[model samples]
Target chain A: MKKQQSRPNILVVNDDGITAPGIKNLIEVVQEIGNVVVVAPDGPQSGMGHAITIGKPLRFDRVDLYPGVEMYKCSGTPVDCVKLAVNKIFKGKKPDLCVSGVNHGLNNSINVIYSGTMSAAVEGAIEGIPSIGFSLDDFSQEADFGHCKKFIKAISLQVLEHGLPPATLLNVNFPKGDNLKGIKICRQANAKWAEEFDERKDPYERPYYWLTGVFQNNDKGEDTDVWALENDFVSVVPVQFDLTAHHAIPVLNTWTFDV
Target chain B: MKKQQSRPNILVVNDDGITAPGIKNLIEVVQEIGNVVVVAPDGPQSGMGHAITIGKPLRFDRVDLYPGVEMYKCSGTPVDCVKLAVNKIFKGKKPDLCVSGVNHGLNNSINVIYSGTMSAAVEGAIEGIPSIGFSLDDFSQEADFGHCKKFIKAISLQVLEHGLPPATLLNVNFPKGDNLKGIKICRQANAKWAEEFDERKDPYERPYYWLTGVFQNNDKGEDTDVWALENDFVSVVPVQFDLTAHHAIPVLNTWTFDV
Candidate 1:
């Protein structure tokens, strides 16, 4: 008989609140591999980025969600969920793997910076845990995650086996549905949301704005995450938390800082 | 007579709310260089990061905070303030330069990811504007910003003269006090907050948590932001919006994708 293997402890989280179907699918997939514990936002926190609630305290409580799968909901951003999980529940013993999302929207290219899903994963990486954030190109409550599960399981297992580079985490995004073209390791595309704020006056005659935008892809490279998703392929981009543009340092150094 | 160049249009913003002393100091510095338009949050959004307000409407209104400065206050995060400034105030005519903060606390090293000030600068860079986020090592309401003004004016002029590299912004932090040892070009230090949730109870006995932490600096490199601040030098790190760990892409591509 092979030596008895130990099950890894997996911490699951998402930005789309604790009850969202995307996270439910992720929970089911990871439960098959390890002992799962989920600490997610109590309400939708889409586009929260790396925000942490500073001026206010968080409301965290236990919830009876899926049977045999322990879960808790925190009234905070996705990053706060991970921090609470790591500090309160795990008690400094970090989970073997921290997986965020299977989000109901795309978080490729420049969207990563404004994505609560990826931010949760980035926080995990900062906390020294091997982490992956998964998202689908679709942004609907009923968006089916059927096709993405097997691939997520495979990729997560690989990460669990061969740990990621230090200070790095995986941002894995899937296209809509089962017409698979396999996985392609990619870089974040040079694209951004060309935002347009819809201005409307309230009943009291005060001006208010609603944020809306169009996804603009200017980078025509085939090796970008945007390209992979557009071509019906799974894109795995390795994201780093160190925002320092190291190459630009020498160029900036040349500038005289005299007043 | 010298060539009469049109005055640069400068957009000023901060996460420390519209009336903060830090932002007032920043506004004073930029008004000396260009035509200033201020759009900042109505309340302190210190750790809001790259978050954008999606689930709610924003209240954007003009305020007479300072005479001769066109200032507006938004009921949103710092990133939202930039978007509103671009969409409504600037009306697609992007500003010559965007300056965020003279933040009450330092946003060096790992704090960059969790900083609204830096995120605003990052947002400006994404919008093809030369941006800079300034911070001080002090965290007091009445922190002395007198010594920081001359240096800020000089740096802003230099950036206006020589535009930064594409997709890049500056994360500039000053040491507290009058004895600044000039500027130092640096990289973000490898440091992080060793966070511990301060648990407490409300009136009904339900537990709540207050996020608090001590910064832990593991990187000993002299060319880092932490080092520059420690040496009483103003640190300027060229920051990028591209979150891709491009170096790790090839290594990930080598992994087989078959389940």
Candidate 2:
């Protein structure tokens, strides 16, 4: 309820590392509307999903990334960055709004499950903060994020002004073109990646594998995030962390799962 | 539809390394009912969530840990193990059932979101397979699993016989005790980890942090997984990967998201 702070404290995070252009553009946009603090991965953590560092301790350090913008980098996954920001940096005095990514690639549909960028935002939502994750469809190092800045600002302002529903976060994805149609409130498209691993031999002739996949969108629904992006519109999906399929509980009760 | 094969082809995976006692116990129980193929992490990948390795290629090799059990160990996450099992090992033919874990610890409530064990089951569900993840509410290396086998078999048989609801997986958690009550169908409890970082200075005087937390469950709903676990009953929560907050969509549509 108190996410609508005047000169809101915005925690900025991403999966594409601290140095990526995506975070820079996002920081610039968020700074216009709030006091920004950036805590991102020290390296590209794409496809890191909702992973956290448990097997090893983390190295967190403050860095002078952008002039006048307080920033830090962590040697862990994107979700780790959010935890560090909340536990260590912010120290439980949570930011008013938590925004993750203007990621180098799309985090639409099923990609949200495997996106480090989105995972950071999910962690923020779990911390009872109004959170949003932004992503641009382009994946190159020099991917143009110019078209996304205005929309990002608008969405962040709206979220700060009107706090999000409890346990929910916004998943926003923008298409590649400059002449965008508009914004669409959409559901996550029923989609997945068809994986193909390229098997190769190492120097000693031991076999190794490279993970690759083709984006597959079989959902023909017009109200899906994937559909909105294809039509040049920015897509926004309200996502929740409760994984329970509430609908299935009644049917499962009919089963005899015994002692 | 064919998860009820006469001799089910079960794809087994875990976040714990291939040699972990948890998976070994799981494999022993599953062998009586189906042909099992296990693809698990080469090392401990706890808290890895749904991460897939994209930054580097993976090292996958066959291991002879169990006699006549088709087992492979991968230098990747639990999610990656499911992917490799489907694409590389099974060549997309698909397994009859995909079961992940018998994790060394609990993956109930909000822990499901950060659990590598549950993430593997989620991956399997995404691949349109009938999947389930099992966890015992004990974090000890020598945790007793003898009481869990019969219940595990009963649930697996039910799932194979009846099949899970589409795009859903079962997150089954057992309360650690030989005098277990029984199984109860439940929903994910609204909960989170109140994280605290144990900051320490290294030998070189550089600061580091060990991520720690206390599980906080304020949800008083008697129909939640937490309640089921706490009351000495096995918790069987039907989980889904669709992060879309369908209920929030109608309200978000009322927002003025402009061009």
Q: Which residue pairs of candidate 2 clash?
A: none
Worst 10 residues of 2 chain B by lDDT: B1-10
lDDT of model 2 at residue A222?
100
The TM-score obtained for chain B by all candidates, in the order given, is: 0.99, 0.97
Q: For every model shown, what is its TM-score relative to the native structure?
A: 0.99, 0.98
lDDT of 1 at B120: 95
The sequence of per-residue lDDT tens digits that candidate 1 reaches over residues A205-249 is 988899999999999999999999989899999999999999899
lDDT, each prediction: 0.94, 0.94
- State in Å the error of residue A258, model 2: 4.6
- Kindly list the per-residue Cα lDDT of model 2 for residues B86-111, writing each as its tens digit: 99889989998999989999999999
TM, chain A, every candidate: 0.99, 0.97
